[model samples]
Target: MMASVNEYYQQMEKTGIPKRFTHVLPPNEIEYKNWLVGQNGLPPVEEWRDRMYAETVKLLKTMQDGCKDQWDDDYWTAVIESKGVESPTNGHSLFSRCS
Candidate 1:
């Protein structure tokens, strides 16, 4: 299902994150921006706003591809907002986290 701007903002707030940036930009637009260029060593367009929303969708789909029930949409949203991809090195994320 296609997500909405409000859904993205809600996801961000659920993680105790400020929704100011994403409140301005939607999720698909935010992801497209990240896929484009960078700004000051950070995501150029709207900063880390709605990143949780986009990443949560990505993570859930990733898990659904193989792991399936290992994570539902809710679980993915939490993890995406929590620690992200959990790389062995940085132990955080591959793409979407601000800090």
Candidate 2:
């Protein structure tokens, strides 16, 4: 018989982190910006903003892959807000607590 989703997640969790966990971007995007700064160039602000936005989305996808439990948005938002990150103004704010 097929295992229930919860059972499957529990088993996977016991086996250490999933392979997708490695797909996350480096925790410090600032390092990338720093490298850019060292390169002697500064183009349109909106372009950098768009790159940040896209990177943020990719990071969120990585988080989703690592989140074995199928938690709804409300649960996650409440968890985030409860942890004093009411707005999660930055990417690290919301995901730094992940196991």
Candidate 3:
């Protein structure tokens, strides 16, 4: 029997290819950028932006994990408003308090 879509995605995740290529640019584009850097000895502007975004996401995840106890709606709402970003959860709580 053929695998379901979820199973296909799970198999892909197991290979770790998706994680390795999480950048918005295609693999060919990234390769070309690397070649350009090799020629000029300077990184592409988009490379720096991608690195900054990845670092910011890592930092935010660490902060969220560290403050799991404070993962209430009020905290998320305040954070979303402070960043001038819309709430991804549509104003709903993203996590439930652990007993």
Best by TM-score: 3
TM-score of 1: 0.22
lDDT of 2: 0.52
Compute each candidate's TM-score over C-alphas: 0.22, 0.23, 0.26
lDDT of candidate 1 over 1-99, digit per residue (tens): 347867866888897768666645553576667666664356555333355556656766676445433324444445445654342334433444323
Q: Which residue pairs in candidate 1 have backbone atoms (N, alpha carbon, C) closer than 3 angstroms, thus clashing?
A: none
Question: Who is ahead in TM-score, 1 or 3?
Answer: 3
What tens digits encode model 2's per-residue C-alpha lDDT throughout 1-99? 346655655655786757465334354445565667668776433343445465556656877556543334454456556656554444333333447
After best superposition, candidate 2 residue 38: deviation in angstroms?
A: 32
lDDT per residue for candidate 3 within 2-70, as digits (tens), equals 466557557658867574454445435557667878799886644444554454455567785454444
RMSD of 3: 12.8
Better of 2 and 3 by lDDT: 3
Q: Which has the greatest lDDT? A: 3
Quote the lDDT for 84 in model 1: 49
Residue 60 in model 1: lDDT:
69
Runs in model 3 lying further than 4 Å from the true structure? 1-70, 96-99
